[model samples]
Target: MSTLAPPRPSPRTTASAGLRGPARLVVRQHRRAFQLLILLTALTAAGLVAVALWAGHDADVFARTGCRVDTVTTDACTRSTRAYDDSQYRLNHSLSVVALLTAVLSAAYGAFMAGPALARELESGTHRLAWTQSVSPARWLTAKLAVPAALTVACTLVLTTVCTWFSTRGTLHPLYWHDTSVYGTTGVYPFAQALCGLALGTLAGLLLRRAFAAMALAAAAQGIAVHVLQNVRGHLWPVVHGPYALARSNPFPRDAWMTEVGYLTGTGERLPMGTCFPIRGKFGDCLDSLGVTRRYADYHPKSHYWPLQLVESGILLAVAALAVYAAHRLLRRLHA
Candidate 1:
């Protein structure tokens, strides 16, 4: 039998060779998108906060002066702490938009950034060249994931922390602001969750070897998982308390979709702005005239918030792990 020769180190064995190019490639491809997204998100959030702070103080002035435009300037010039209700309409609306924007943009960006590194290499046959060289497939994948993942996680955490701080001050009827709509689902926590989705999407891109295709699959996977988990896990394993009811006793104007007034009263009824009127003759006429009559209370279980977040974050991390595993396996199998 012919003697077998010992294996020789591949040309790309040197640390400098395998890493530098891929690192640059990832940054160059994704940098502009990241910058634009961050700029837009921050700017929108800032604008909203500015408007809220201004409006919060102005609201009290308007109330005191019976909304006379002339007194507005005087009131603003001598603004007092009492005038500023931190949990006012502008603040709530701003925070809601910020939350939704952060969630959608983060998810999209994360997937976009991650969708092309290894799969493209595999598609183009360059991965085989690297595999033939001395570069370990696992190491290559690690390098590919580490830099972006770290940067993304750090960035998201920073933004979310700040947003969460502001969010705590918001006082609008939480249910009115947040419902089962898309706007309700996104928030500071959701942004963090989306980062995990991005990591998983990126991992999928590496394994699947196509950007849009992998991204589509990733998005679908995330959407379905989030929906199912939000429903099932929320009902079964709630983090916050449950069966919490909203306290709006009056019907909002037919044209009015949401309200920014009042707190939950005892017995869980929405106490309307107008003084309570007994359901008697003259009182009924007054209710009809001003449209201020009692109705059923609005309610939401507290479990909707924290527990859902915990579950979504866990699922995303799981997806990220699976992506990493698949990337390692596929890259290892590539032969020169």
Candidate 2:
């Protein structure tokens, strides 16, 4: 008896079969997370565009009113400055909120990575089934991390680029280059921070293997990282010390980060500016009485902005690398 040859698989079926691996499984399992990531990216892009357009409109108004001239006392100048400052305040506030939201979402992503993506599978014994199939445990973990890591980095880079563009606009209202929120969002720092979060989450997942515990630990780790980094950010670059008069022209170059201003004693010691507090008579007289020979400041010049950002980014990336390495080692040990 001649058995009918089995029908050949269709091209679509063949293609789907070829895709039946760890990578596709990871995508299918976390499809909702990926969908949310796309939505978040679109919203962030739209918000940034809206802010840019609004700032551009305000800038146009400032230009039409001829408020570019340096005038501190004219009624027109005062009105113009007020309008400009108001617009700036709104822009900065909005940007700050967006930056904060980005940070929060990044941290939440870390927690999700730990809880839902990794630990849940381990907890439910689903990972064992995946391992027994065509996927090895290491490959399964790699696929899980590779997808989210790629998406996170791509989205963060886009957001950072948009933020950098917003920062370059010459609106009457200017954001300080050293402002924490501004700096965090406008450079490579955001990308590093997001990657760090992802690595920390993965490590947490491997360690705890319990969804809630991993999520909580990952979130806490992210919070501690942000707090510590913020506290030490000023020291990431060398501080330039100089006569404070250099600051008097504009308090600082528009882009310089003025960290501290103080009195320089005749003996060459630095005293808090508070020593000259409550300037009563001549400011110099008050300083002389305090044995101050000159005014001084500790600052990071505008030129140091990139250096500072690079330093911070490097530190964060190093931490992320360590976390990832530790996760890999832990996985190997567990499976050994």
Candidate 3:
């Protein structure tokens, strides 16, 4: 009798050969979702790069005319200048929107975690079967969160790095770095937002055990968290202030985030923007009557971008950690 050699794993199994135990099992269940996620992400990132390259070519064509790209003065400028500016605007706007969509999807990972990942199992009692097969509640929960979280971070990293690179190197337009949609997608901050969504979704699923309800709750919560963070981000770091003399002038760079613009009182107190608006009589007389000394402006300079990103990311991560802990405790109470 011929001796049989060891069997070879199938190609599908071989591709995922390294994954074992709960990790592999989780992947098997959500393979379709993962496939769809990766496909969409790849297409979006490709579009971003393509747009950037097209913009670069347009910029070069416009510059060759020896026309000042910034000012539209009639210097025998060809129609190419207007066309170039229009193209740049469209491309940059597309870049911002697509990158923002990717970030939003990362945050929507919570809905997956809340519905199909956790609540589905709990609602249908599938988790009980896993628990009987040498898997505790904690192990089961970890498997659900860890695999998806890893995928979220991986997808986010690729898209964000591409966006950041395009924003810095590819964009020749006058787009500001701190545009809300653009900022939300560009750094470690989006990664933090993803984690926060995942944890909150987990918590919601654990509490509700109903897929639809849990998903809705998690998504709404994530949206609120994102909005709250974005709203408060400027205040996270002290802004660079412009002197009263520069009030009527923008001393900050064109790309800086202007947090405030107003007038300064003689006693050095800041006044609102319309302090002398509608200019009754002489502008100087109105200023003198109101004790307005000069103009005041507050802005976060370009250099402060990274610091703002880092600080907000830290705060979000802390919130995510607490949410995870609370989820674990609740699961333990329910099971034990």
Candidate 1 Cα errors over 4 Å, as ranges: 1-25, 63-87, 126-134, 172-188, 236-308, 334-336
| RMSD to truth, every model | 10.2, 4.5, 4.7
Work out the TM-score per prediction. Answer: 0.59, 0.85, 0.88
Question: Which candidate comes out best when scored by TM-score?
Answer: 3
Please identify model 2 stretches exceeding 4 Å from their true place. 1-20, 65-86, 244-251, 278-286
Candidate 1 vs candidate 3: which has greater lDDT?
A: 3
Instruction: Write the residue-wise lDDT of candidate 2 on 1-336 in tens digits.
Output: 899999999989965564457778778888898888888878877887887787678767877887654666678877877777777777777778778977897688789889999999889988888877756677778888888888888888888888877666645557778876688788788988888889899999999999999999999999899889888888888898877542254455667777887777778888887875578677777776778766787888878888888888898889889998999899999996
Candidate 2 — what's its lDDT? Answer: 0.81
1 against 3, candidate with superior TM-score? 3
Per-residue lDDT tens digits for candidate 1, residues 1-336, read 899898876766656666775566556755776576567656765675576566656665546655442344455533532344443655666666666665565557446644655556656766556556555667656656776666666566555555555555444324232343222334434544565566666666665677677777666665665566546543434222122223434443322223234333445544464443455567646544555433442233343455555555676567667766765676557532
Pitting candidate 2 against candidate 3, the one with the higher lDDT is 3
lDDT of 1: 0.54
List candidate 3 stretches off by more than 4 Å: 1-19, 67-78, 169-172, 246-248
Model 3 clash pairs?
Answer: 247-295
Better of 2 and 3 by TM-score: 3
